[model samples]
Target: MGSGDGALNTPRWLRGIWVIPLAFLLVFLALPLVVLIIRTWSGDGWRILANASTWQITALATVQAVLSTVLSLAVGLPIAAVVSRYSFRGRALAQALVTVPFVMPTVVVALAFRSLLGSALPQGFLIVVLAHAYVNLAVVVRIVGSQWSQHDDRYARVAQTLGATPLTVFRTVTLPYLRSSIISSSVVVFIFSFTSLGIIVLLGDSSTRTLESQILRRTSVLLDFPAAAALAVLQLIVICIVIALGAVASRKRGQQKPVRNALLSMPTNRASRTAIHLIAVCSCAIVLLPVFALLIASVRSNSGLTTQWWTSINAIDSGTTRIGSPVASLAQSLQFALITGIVASLVGGCAALAVLAHRWGRFIALFAIIPLGISAATLGLGMLLAFGRPPVDLRASGLLIPLAHSLVAVPLVVAVIAPALRGIDPRAREVAATLGARPTRAFFTAYGPTLRTVMLAAGGLACAVSLGEFGAASFLARTGAPTVPIQIVRLLSRPGEQSYGVAAVMSLILIALTLVLVLVVDRLGRRNGALRPAH
Candidate 1:
């Protein structure tokens, strides 16, 4: 087929499939952004941009985000080198444990850091940076590991065989191969750290205020929605610039040639093998120490490791303080997760499939990823402005959080499902069509089974995302029916050992749910025989 044969080359059944996802992004994604712009304009919120403090915070956040990204890469690169390159014992578990912090709620991670560090590390710049680095460890490991696993170490061997030293070989040969993934992951870590809200709120002093926290303060505390909108715009601008720079840097990495062999066998030498296992152990400790600290904190008290909090889990109610009970908040979170799973899978799945259907698919796909560059604070404040009231109010309807979450999760869903969809053989559909099957039937014959399997997997991921989302939930949740993260934050804000105990317990529960979902998604990806590399 020639380049001119474009959308017409697509199967009839697949054509025009972009409509559903387009409508979704327009109504939910684009609308909210438009609302933000209008709200900022009408309220003269743009004037807040003139505040010198805003720029100071922006400068401060950039520095903090840079340090966080550096630390994450420092910690994650070694673990990625060990886990992804070596075929050693506990390799699978090491990889799984590395991802735990990434999936856990931001607020929950904040609590774990606070509990783990306690009074030893003050709640300010260092603590906040550490928390950001911890949460972003997976971003570095997964992104860089994906490329590192496929990297041809033979290049290094060749260089080493020459006059080059080990460090020189790494700098000359290996680093170039890993540069793209490193830049990509660095951008992600930097954005998360810069736009961070939960960790900054819980573990930060005035020294660590981000535009995200500033927006939250302006909205909920100062009752200045206009000023919040201004901050949101500023945050979005910074994120867009970073994302653009990352894209350019990634593109600038020299052409990546395919390698015949990617994965390496377990090393034979004693020191080398020991080093791999040691790094794996150290990585696991880095990921799990905070979690273990939270666990111990949950049961311990001034009375020396009591179980009163565990026993009182059923009776603990934050409803009197305008939040729901622990059980009720969990239920609320579950419900939101379910809805988010259903909505995001459907919407994002359509977006993925659109790629096979029309040339317009690229635009739709890029549009869907827009949420990635927008901070959660912006998303939440935009939701509030757009649908919290008015001619169209979904505030008390219990659908707002799910809708917002669906928008957030759709990008992930597309990331998971699109590659698998693209991996399917078009010849299967053509074979079915040759057998006199209709267009829809033929399309189904090729894609239906894979779609079903991966949809469930993608849905599980969306559910996991909804389970732990905090920043947006904080803005949109009603006082009476707070989600799990919201309730946890509320509990921690109050005084006493009881509050601390309950919050820790909830954090562990949130951890369990997210990990279970991720585990299931991993299994489904394997079973579907998708593009993901098998262990």
Candidate 2:
């Protein structure tokens, strides 16, 4: 029997996994959006769409996002070429390091940049663009790098042998091969920058306002839900257009033949070797500098280096009335993380299983990724409209934040688990069934090992997402209980040395927690033989 036949033979219990994800998405994702539409329909939301300021902000954000995309590509292309084309000592570490900034909470990144360039550079359009580039560096590297690594280098070698210079060969041959990936990555970076909230909130001025920032302002600062809803809808429409354009651009060319993994070799000439090493070192330094600066800011005070910020983590009054105790925030974050991990894994795992067992699985999988395109601010506002008050008030209930977080995390969980599940051989399950095992037993026998590893990995990732999430949490979190990111933003808003120091300390704690979770996920995946070294 074919793999599809075997998958179809899955037990009744196994086939029912789709229901959980379907129900979860309907209740949490679709319902909230429906509520948002209804609420906006009842208000004067439609008027805001025709406002000149809205379109002006959209135009400016597009310009900023374009600049950020261009800068990220310029910086990331070389790093992607080095890491993907040539494997060297510490290459794995280098690739992992590049990903760190991308996974960091936007609020943390904004704070780190502020602390790193204090008084040296002023926050404005340029600073915001640079920060956007920094955070999105990984998207370019990973997307373009994966394609670059698979690229057949024989074309470049042939060009060289025919009297083409290195630069000429890159321009004529290498660029064409990487064009699709470059476009794909650029589109993703643009969307991120265009809809950005945390960075824009912290670093932007009048010129850098995004539709997302305007939504937050309207909802929180102005209590203008109708206008916020209008902006959110406009932002979503723009994002959809951009994503559609990217999809079309990326698929314009026919698929290239898959190439086998090419063995990495060290550069023969001294000049080439020195350049590669320098790029690698510089990449590491660039990624680490802001983090190191944050670390320094946590301990150093006006007088001198001290443990004051760390010690004051548990105090309610840390020289700020607007901020709460760091200890309380930490506890709140952990609680939310634990809940998000379980909820996301369950929902996402089921979605993956459904994809494996159903004929419509591919469609379902595609549908599940819809959240990835939705901005966090948009999702937050939807959840607020749906569950924040009245008929289905869930604001005081602790489930609201975790539910929002799970929505954010489900896409990631599905991405990680679906691929691993699809790769498992179906024949093992047939063998188990022939040995007289039950359908459930046979299913587990074939896929249990991988499911366990990926679930743990997915759960860990969910925890990390909950810990660093700022946008949705900003909408859902109560004033008394805030997540770490929320607390940090509040501290930064207030002007006090103690507040800054404490925020720094909290940021460091968040960084450490995020890194540990990711590392644990990597290790777990490796142990289960799901993760392997990249070529």
Candidate 3:
């Protein structure tokens, strides 16, 4: 690690180590794509894409995703407006609560929604759409809210002064300012909703079929690898098209920011202030209710509020007779999370460092992030083909999940560390040299503490991801070695109140663990000012 002019002067050993991340991406990422393409092109998979059901389901998923995106924007824009612009008491906590849903495992969120909306809303199109909106609220809030806080309000004031009504001012002035951010957030939410698997499985009916869910069905239930590969290809095409269109729309509108961020301001009138605070309060409630419901569900039973489920968590037969202890899934998830943490930190940290040191640094950084565009389900299936077989059996080695998760998480790790690394002061090393410190010691003086904090934070975030990850784990987890998310799904699929109670218990545990990891990441990231956005 180094800074400024010294950035390119990083140790040769560090530069050479960049190959580890590269080879990892190759073996896991590139090889998988090649294998998937071969399977798709060489088999009868291409003909499956021509089936009328394929396009029919794709059309249905597109409509569902569009509705989910619209609903998320409608809900999220209001929460973002209150949390980002109008500062008030508990503002930080409100923003933090908004993020909890996004980071929670999709499967866990599905169960929580079932707990919260039972009888009030049946599980189908409406509930699936609502659940998707709830889960994706953060994508809109964080992305658009960051941009919302930066734009100058003078434009709105001027429009109002010219006799525009409040709605007119917003439509004409504020909305234009956030066009790019809204488009960006919309694209992400749409893609997520379109590719949803866990939520769709738990909360959706035939009307809400997504290609992701279809791929899983074709693969496991039908034992139709060719059909699954065909679905994968179709899914990739749709995602690429959406991304391409989002890019075009964003490029056309562009982004317009104030020369400098405006100062944080609060509404002056009692009515305006009351409205903002009320909205903030409601937003927090919306975020927390499902979680609370999940908690209650864990304790509630036919006899009225019993502790039977919590007590049975450690029993050898907590799940279906074949699956062994439910506690075992937690242990498996933790073990995998730790492995993912270590692998992702090393690989992602190296990729970030390479950006400051190698001539092809930007390429390595770009290569690492490519996994973000690929679906976890797709990558898991690819890994299954590439490494779950005769030539190599990562499934047998129990490294497949960690390796896939590391690829999934490395981009986020790079995002966290690169800026912090670049922000370091190079002159610190020179000062250390003047103090007679050795070159290695001098480099550490410049970058050691910051790198240490960021890497730790990044690793924690990776661990949180592995803990809640469902799409990949659902596909790759051995029948008997289910991860927490997979186990939760299995529990929810069976027919009984005890099953629901036990599932809720496991979901709550996963949420607690994830929240703890996020808290640690936040604490570490704050040391370098990367966690919180400036007002």
Candidate 4:
């Protein structure tokens, strides 16, 4: 439509678009943080900061995070190069499957690792790093893969034609193109590992503890609110600084054109093809081994391999002291999932829309993502202090876990929706207005379809996130009303072959649930053409 047509159709409210998202950030993101800060400040918060153990944990967490990031990149970059840059028969499936580990609950991943490699490898730094790397593979693959897809292969070809060695061409051209994505994905992976709770708790020794774990210990184990708050502040500062650095690094790459889909090509040489196949097969095996182990354990028993675990899932707790029935955990987890999905989508969707509606949208959007920086344990602790008490005890109400999960998920929803909102053509609203649609109707006309698709996608993402979430759930979970992750932890804490086997079975179920949620979400996005190659 022409500019005049757009101007005539445009509504007055577009001028004040900032109000919605700002309000959202104020209530959901800003308020909780303020409460945390106040609680810390009210006590001797500064002394807590001076504690040597705090720095020790932070340093260790940083080291672990860095190592995890490196491993994820090393593993993910190759798979990304293959699936995004080259087409094979199962390329789409491969891409989707790689995201499985990321979406699975950290506890599930940790248990799977124990089942797979626990006997062979002790749980500590190495196992912790491996589990982290496995979980974060999707971040590297999706982010870097997006950039790799856009990489003009012809540039490498041109370098080769000019006598540049393959290694040199990659170093000079391909690496430079991927640098921003690398930095961004690295920061994200680092943050995840640094603030890790479930995996570290389940698979780590004292050396593997992060500030997140520390916060949980302070709040729940020690009942030291001030100390927990201080640790949370320190963690938030570190995360913000890292995120800022990533933003700067990404900006150095400047504006890049979105990549349209490119045709996939198979390797021409037998050696090159064999290498590609080897990498693909090995990557898949590495990713699936732990899950396979978990599956086997779920069905095995003392005599030998049996379907007893699966068969007795319904009756697993009939005559036992287990927290609840094994099957009951599934029902509890599903209920939480439903609540989390609805709440996060509404809150996060509003926050995203608020971003498009206001001048301060970027700030609000940034605030929404702050949960990514805060450890799940810290958030859980703060929520506990703020709401887990007698007068406002949400734990009894059965809303605390879902509420906490929603807090963690709001940022993801904003991430998914904001970029999509940016991609919508502003002129569409104008066109709708010119056709005599009301302002609100025009705005919906422009963004409604994409919003609908992304909201569901975001909701599914939130549900999947909540499904696998262990750390925060660990803090907020009541003794009698344990979620699956909580149940898994309880099972692991106990002694016996039966306990371990049952835990493994639960881990497998959790993994399957998470994978199903993610695949379904990916499928929806695909249907909406969101997963199609960008131009």
- Could you say which candidate leads in TM-score? 2
Query: Once superposed on the true structure, which residue ranges of model 2 sit more than 4 Å away at CA?
Result: 1-4, 252-258, 316-323, 531-535
Candidate 4 weakest lDDT stretch, 10 residues: 1-10
Task: Give stretches of model 4 more than 4 Å off.
Answer: 1-24, 253-259, 318-322, 425-432, 441-446, 531-535
TM-score of 4: 0.91
TM-score-best of 1 and 4: 1
lDDT of 2 by residue, 1-535 (tens): 1126875558887666677888888888888788778777889998988889989999999999999999999999999988877878988788889989987889999999999986787888998998999999999999998888888878888999999999999998888888898998998899999999999989899999999999999999999998898888889899999988988887766554547676468789999988888888888888999999999999999999989988988884544544568888899999999999999999988888888777666666676778888899889999999889888888888889998999989988888888788788888988999999899899899999899889989899999999999989998888878899999998888888888999999999999999999888878867766442111
lDDT of 4 at 477: 87
**What is candidate 1's CA lDDT for residue 341?**
98
- Per-residue lDDT of candidate 3, residues 1-535 (tens digit): 4324555445557657668779988988999888988998888888887799999999999999999999999999999988887657799999999999998999989999999897798889999999999999999999999888787887888888999999999898888888888999999999999999999999999999999998888878997877887788789889999999999888855445563556356767889878888899999999999999999999999889999999988883656557867899899999999999999989988898788767677788899988877787888888888887788888978899888888888988888887788888778877887798776787778889988988888899999989988887777888878898998998888898988999999999999999999889988777778543111
Cand. 2 Cα-lDDT: 0.87
Candidate 2 residue-wise lDDT at 32? 79
Model 3 residue 436 distance off true place after TM-score fit, in angstroms: 5.2
Give per-residue lDDT, candidate 1, residue 158: 87
- Model 3's lDDT to the true fold? 0.86
Tens digits of per-residue lDDT for model 4 on 1-535? 1123344443456444445545645654566678789988888876977878878888888999999999999999998888788877777767777877877788888998988889899989999999999999989998998889887677778899999998999898888889888998999899999988889889999889998888888877898888888888888889889989889877874433445775458879999888777777777787788889898888777799887667766675655544887778888889998899998888777766656655455666677777777778777877777778877777899998998999888888787777777788888887887798898899899988998888888888888888878888988887767888888888788887677788888888887787777777777777776422111
